[model samples]
Target: MGKSPSVGVLHEDDCDEVKFFEKPRKNLQSDDENVDGRPGWLPDGWIMEVYCDDDGTIYRYYICPLSGTTFTTKSEVLDYLFSEMDQCFLESKNHAVGSNLTRTHEWLPKGWLVEIRAGGDNMDKMYKFYVYPPNRVRLFSKDDVLIYIKEMKISGFDTDGQCNTNTQENILAILEFNPEGLPQGWVKEVVFRKTNTGKIRRDRHYTDPIKNYVFHTKRSAALYVETGKVTIRAFVQKTSVHEMYSFEKFTHLHESLWKRLELGGTNQLRTRLSKLRKLSLKEEILSDEQGSTSAEDCNSDNSDTAHGAGQNKVSHLASTTVKRPRGRPPKQGNARK
Candidate 1:
């Protein structure tokens, strides 16, 4: 059996240096009330907080704007963002990515993240981080969209209360925004809006694709042609057709159009409106095509028709000229006076 090696006792001079001499004190101040309406236990640097009245749900939000990544204090959001970034870093980890790449220190709490920049020329481009099963932001998170609706209300832009809540959420994706992300005016050739019950109920409108005119039905589309106004009485029977009005000096590109309407429930009206829109669009296209052809294709045979029936009447008049005097010989009657 090997003899155990003797351990030597060291004096204070022989001991290794200890960098931290005393235990560190903990920060108990973080437990105080948070004015941001978040849980007191959650760490700081949460920029936005959300609540749901339906389920009494609360969501705390943090975002990395450079990567367009949002975190929900859930380990998963953070884990995904870091994993993707780290994977990119493994490929080409260059330190001097860009001078202009900004790092936000004040906005984030300690240990969440340090300054994140594009590591190299290859990675400087945005690494879009998407949240699975996106929450309300997936549908309606833009401030400009909400502001646009409010302005439309102030300007008296009214719609049939058919648009449900889901359709309005879709509309939020369509409302115009300037380059700076401020709401402008309504840009959709047709739009759906929220109603009293906060559910859009029906097909709000039909649109003339050619004129970009909004109306109530396929009949109303042509009604504009008949009366210079589109008064669709699909909902009301006695109201007069009114002229549509719009705001000026707003630039709304067609790129912002919503792909589909999100009907809250009972999509029967939506299906009918879609069929009507297709039929109306085809009719408009046919009319435009036929208008030019009908004018240019006049029959040339009509030019050969003669007007000699007057001469035959003149030949017959001589036989009846034996005192065909008219007006009852007024001069003879006047002699009584």
Candidate 2:
């Protein structure tokens, strides 16, 4: 029997390697002879090259004329063809009207419908793509289509609100539990905010039920839960009579909680009061240190002034007093005689 054709022996070659073989200039037209040595199956504009190595093993490679790229297997060629078809479909949809615009192609499966629609105002134009399955259910976006297909595969039923299997998992059930080995009563909450530009932003908050504390980020919450200490950084704005200064201040977690607690949460009234008391104690300690420094400076200045005043008094007395002569005796009666 003849040796079976080796499917795995085909490999793509570089431009330098293609220079070694003399390529056919004329295109093959008849179905009797085709590229890859397979009659009546090869695509147009694609040429095949066959070669033998020193070990006598045969290799076949397919080259694309449009892209000048090489493919080693039939699957690669099929993938390129389908991708080109999709590109053409998208180009056609771009010029289509804003109505239903449903289309079906020979390449698509039976009863599958694709639709493209242009929406939004003139200032903000957007295109929305949708797909309808054989069951006539509409799926929006590629992700929705993928999810629908996945559900069909897993449950083997049309997902028209009749599938008994629980396909959609609860995200909070996965996130609320402590995944990062956080403390036992801590729960995670996700907050989504939309900006003025219609963009969505997600923020994570971890809540500690035991201490009634809510941390904005995971790292900070983890640090406090594990170590009982955290550093909070905030931008402080100080306004004076003539100018305003903005500076960043880093304080201990407990001290900053007072300001944050004031923003909301009437249920945390006791917690806020306790945090305020702790904050006041810290401020008192800082004020005491500043007072002691100023007192020491004042004492030093007072002592220097007192010493200079004493020296001036001595100099003034010396200048005003009369100086005694070298002979020592100076009485009133001796002077008269």
Task: Say which candidate scores most in TM-score.
Answer: 2
Q: Worst 10-residue stretch by lDDT in candidate 2?
A: 241-250
TM-score, each model? 0.16, 0.20
* Model 2 quality (TM-score): 0.20
User: After superposition on all CA atoms, what RMSD does each candidate show versus the true structure?
Assistant: 28.6, 24.5
Write one digit per residue (lDDT tens) for candidate 2, span 222-332: 666434554473112232101110111111222222332233233465578889999999999999999999999999999899989989999999999998778867898
Model 1 residue runs over 4 Å out of place are 1-46, 84-337
Q: Rate the local accuracy (lDDT) of all candidates.
A: 0.34, 0.45
Which pairs clash (backbone N, Cα, C closer than 3 Å) in model 2? none
Tens digits of per-residue lDDT for model 1 on 1-337? 9999999876886554332332121112222333245554333543455544455333456654333345666574556454564333222213212111111112211222111011123221111111112222221122323443356321222112222232234332221111111111111222444453457434434332223355555456444432346474533312111111111112222222212322322266567889999999999999988985675454323322323555667778977788766676667667888
